[model samples]
Target chain A: EAGVTQFPSHSVIEKGQTVTLRCDPISGHDNLYWYRRVMGKEIKFLLHFVKESKQDESGMPNNRFLAERTGGTYSTLKVQPAELEDSGVYFCASSQVRIVSTEAFFGQGTRLTVV
Target chain B: TQLLEQSPQFLSIQEGENLTVYCNSSSVFSSLQWYRQEPGEGPVLLVTVVTGGEVKKLKRLTFQFGDARKDSSLHITAAQTGDTGLYLCAGALTGSARQLTFGSGTQLTVLP
Candidate 1:
């Protein structure tokens, strides 16, 4: 089976511009998660989705960031009027179960550079 | 503040050497996992320790969980160049198992 896949392996945009990153999880996986790692920081959780409904979004940085998973399939993360601090790598992950110890497969990640 | 603290944020050693990295936290976790990530790629799960004081070994790598479930360690024996990468430790807190708390990560360099 294919692992989680993320689009636009790298992205570069000007400050205040918009960018959308996409993620395609493994087939039949119901749990999807988003994470980001800024320069010299840990990879922080952003949000999670079980099917098309968001399970948790407490980790989302601010209002300028939005995420959606339609039809309980793929997911997208959009950042509007992006800031310099938003430059970092965004990662998507998936797992078949919701248990704490379940194995989660991760995507290569999208490197975003907000100039 | 970092919930999980990983010692020696960066490590460099010659091939055939042995090294051990540590991950510590004050909060208790139901489970803790270690992952290895290469440049431009996401982290890959190396091992997960659930039971306190449990120890698991894979090839030349050994993983140990603290007796309190609040810490973990990874020891690499006779390291190889292929072992070079970023090592990250993440945990699922007792109640909040849905989200994982990650450490800052240790960048390991094994020179051949």
Candidate 2:
């Protein structure tokens, strides 16, 4: 079975530039999540999608960040006019979304560096 | 905000030694999970403890959940070089969405 996969393992962009990160979750999984980890900081949750609907997006930092899951398949997170603070590693994970503890499989993550 | 605290931000020890890492929080959680991550890779789930005071062992690693469901511990016996990585503990607060609040993380190094 294929695991979660993310695009552009490393991205380097200048401030005020726009960047988009993509995530392809495992097939047959209903739950997809986005997370971020800044330099010297632990990983933090960004949002979660259940199929095509967003289950929870309370973790989104600001309006500059937009996430879309078209057709409930792959997800894309776009950062407009990225700032220095936007430099971090973005991770994507997928699970079955069950009442019981369903293990979440994470992608290698996209490392973004905004200079 | 719910936060998980991890002790010993970093640890370095010789192989074959034993060590224990802890995760604590003031808020009670419905479930807790442990993950190990290597550089250039994402974190992998190690174990999940739901019931309070529950204990689960994975080979040389033993995991224990606090009786109050507010704390947890990971004990590694006969640590090996393969065990060296970043250990993270996450909590799912009761009545909240499936989002997990992760701890500060503990970096463990096992020298060969």
Best by lDDT: 1
- Give the per-residue lDDT digits (tens) of candidate 2, residues A1-115: 9999999899999999999999999998888999999998778999999999999999999999999999999999999989999999999999886765436788999999999
- The per-candidate TM-score of the B chain, in the order shown, comes to 0.98, 0.97
Q: lDDT tens string, model 1, B1-112? A: 8999998899999999999999999999888899999998999999888999999999999999999999999999999999999999998888774678899999999998
lDDT of 1 by residue, A25-54 (tens): 999998899999999899999998989999
DockQ (0 to 1) for model 2: 0.68
Which docking class does model 2 fall in? medium
Chain B, model 1, TM-score against the native? 0.98
Q: What is residue B90's positional error in candidate 2, in angstroms? A: 0.9
lDDT of 2 at B37: 91
C-alpha positional error of residue B28 in candidate 1 after TM-score superposition, expressed in Å: 0.7
Instruction: Mark the regions of model 2 whose C-alpha exceeds 4 Å error after superposition.
Output: none
Tens digits of per-residue lDDT for model 2, B48-90: 8999999999999999999999999999999999999999998
